[model samples]
Target: MNDIVDLFVIGGGVNGTGIARDAAGRGLGVTLAELGDLAQATSSASSKLIHGGLRYLEFYEFRLVRESLQEREKLLAAMPHIAWPMRFVLPHHSGLRPDWMLRSGLFLYDRLGGRGLPGTKRINLRSHPAGALLKPSFRTGFEYSDAWVDDARLVVLNARDAEMRGATILTRAKVVSTTRHAAHWDVEVERDGRIHTHRARKLVNAAGPWAGKLSETTGDPHRLRLVRGSHIVLPRLPGHDQPYILQGGDGRIVFVIPYEDDFTLVGTTEAEHHGSASEAVCSPEEKAYLVDFVNDYFAHPISTDDIVWTYSGVRPLIESEGSARSASRDYQLAYDDDGAPLLTVLGGKLTTFRKLAESALERLGYGGQWTARAPLPGGTFDRRQGVAMIGRWMEAHPFLTEAWARRLLRSYGTEAETILGNAATAEDLGQDFGATLSEAEVRFLMRHEYARTAEDVVWRRTKLGLRLDAGQVAALDAFMAEARGEAAAAE
Candidate 1:
């Protein structure tokens, strides 16, 4: 729209925003544009683990598992508010893999990439609290440590950090076209029905499932394996906070995680996606597959009727010769600088987005690995400080419920203070949208987090959608629409 920037990133997913944040922090001008809300796709649909892909070891993805393991510790340390350690229980299935194999794999997992988490140990399920929930036949199991993260929040924070570092962040903006030039590239982006043209010395295509399509804009044809992964959320199991990793007859593994505060998150089936990513959904067959698998292990049985919600996302995996289940989650960068500089990110995972960004920038001829240690926006405190911050907020604002305070702290971290402001009581929050969603928090998300819709706030920014009633959601939607209209009129 104005001066030529150093880098123009297409796609506001984890990789695009991460590269923009990295490039901007290194004194390079950066601009990022997304067609929709950040992390509205695969980034938010993950199984929500920051593990080393323990199952990846069987496929001999040692390198990926190692890198992921290393990132787990870094991310856990960097953002303790939205991320924390979770213990996973893997029950032994002699019918699938042998006990010796499981033990050996666990050993390698514990030693790989400087394990900061607890080592694996065998347990008697019958005696363990988690075991009581399982069938009596499942007598033995193993427990190990991994972390859970708010995947959508991770993308948003990166974008926020990038904007603070002088990158132009545009949501609901689509890259209409791009043309190569001698020293730069001209890009046209459509936002609010207006076409804005800009110039950049370098262009990056990190469009997730749309990367291949974006590459076509540059006259390069690239294909990726679009694997649809789907997850189902059930009403929370009565006891235990720990999650389970169950093996299937087909050799694939499914995770049954503790989701939100009152739900069990189970998934996912990896089937080849035939259509656009936007149309991906949990097929009826996949639903039956998951239900049957879980029923095979747990004492309490559930059918599709028990599922409260389901989500699906298409992963743009590097095309490889194998079943979609065995496809590589590793990413590749295709750099073409024949006349104008262009770098297209082929495939990537949520855990390795930072390293992928650094590599992308280095290929674009940028300097330094500054993002490795830098904290994300609102992530300046250590784990102890995070707990203390929550305690202090609860102390100062005695009107706030413990559950509300904890949720806000985990979602916004220290920025919750800004949203709380000088409000002495709950009424100052303006309007109560139910499920602890106050108007103050909604405005905070709108003002800073690029949340333009109630779905953006309820589903992605916060999982409060699961708790809100239908009428509450409709009211929130109406409120957001009015607020957006008012803001547009003012502008």
Candidate 2:
């Protein structure tokens, strides 16, 4: 049995953690439960972007676009470590959207959010660096500004901040059942082969694709349409630092972004997903579709064989009459106060998560909105200081490599020193499990970041999974398990 909390969050994704962080910061007791590792599902498998959906303008989603654009700068400022600005080049295809339409859309996008980022401009592809990599047919293009993010890290940071603000975070804790009463709700959470009971004054369903199924238990009539968005990673396409937004004839768009320095990330295909959301994988068709889509734009065509990695996430969108690509990225907060207040988050995107959290709290009648101005964990410094911070790290620790220092800065920002701590040489960081993943860093992640498994460390906490091989991953997993066992035995 546990003390009755003010809010019980069911899920550990972006939305759930965001709500927990917001509520906890406002002096509300919060407990968040996740069935798996934090960001093990949809949250970690995103296209890794924090941008207003440029294509949403085509569907006349003015409100969604406006909200997302407004949030873009705020989010970037909040977490400069994990989120930073990126320039996107959209090649003007004669057969697709016309020049005037693109210009008009870009114009609206630039002004919609008060123009914090650089505005759009027309560029001659033949003379531009990005154009050198593109097909000759793309003589001209439009460049606009957006941002990139480490999607999984964003969720973990929110959870970390929430925990710091007095919220209880339970990873691998499954909410087995929930019983609502007139004043509170009784929730049963199963973890470590045992079931724990908790009581809360309010319940939140931020389970992403699983929200629909969880709604049945709360007796809420809301449903969600599961749409799978998949992405493929290929070896880095040279000659361009800016990412390209390739327009497709099928009214879809694919992003070819530089990823992890040595690789390129191209995605994502929108397809209606069925069955279990957890089982969603990048299918052969999705891979082929992405390959074919990029081939149309790149001067050097790539086959599916060039794909080094693929990931898929099932997005729980609002049930509407349209194709999955045309579905709304806008979120709806369904507040059911028949008994205990139940707030169900329906649909949302990465860019507007903070706004969504504000809305969720507002629905629950909690006021003091503070996340917009506050920085997340490890993000207390100015956004523009990232590069200087990394340089300082290298200057202070002359033994550290530029790549290692840069990775640490990007992952931990000002807190990287906490891990580096008094180490005069790289050997002081202890065992290296390949890909610059030192034991010191691993311990920090496990102790502070709620990282239990290597999957959580490599894939979610940092993208070292792209660099580590199978044997190295296995070794890392073994090391983590052994470390956990030793800690448990000691306890």
Superposed on all Cα atoms, the candidates' RMSDs to the truth, in angstroms, are 1.1, 0.9
Per-residue CA lDDT of model 1 for 326-394, tens digit only, reads 888999999988877899999889899888999999999988788875788777788777667877888
Name the top lDDT candidate.
Answer: 2
Candidate 1 positional error at 338, Å: 0.8
Off by over 4 Å in 1: none
Q: How many times do residue backbones clash in model 1?
A: 0
Q: Estimate each model's TM-score.
A: 0.98, 0.99
- lDDT tens digits, residue span 164-219, model 2: 99999999999999999999999999998999999999999999999999999889
lDDT of 2 at 398: 87
lDDT of each: 0.90, 0.92
Residue 116 lDDT in model 2? Answer: 88
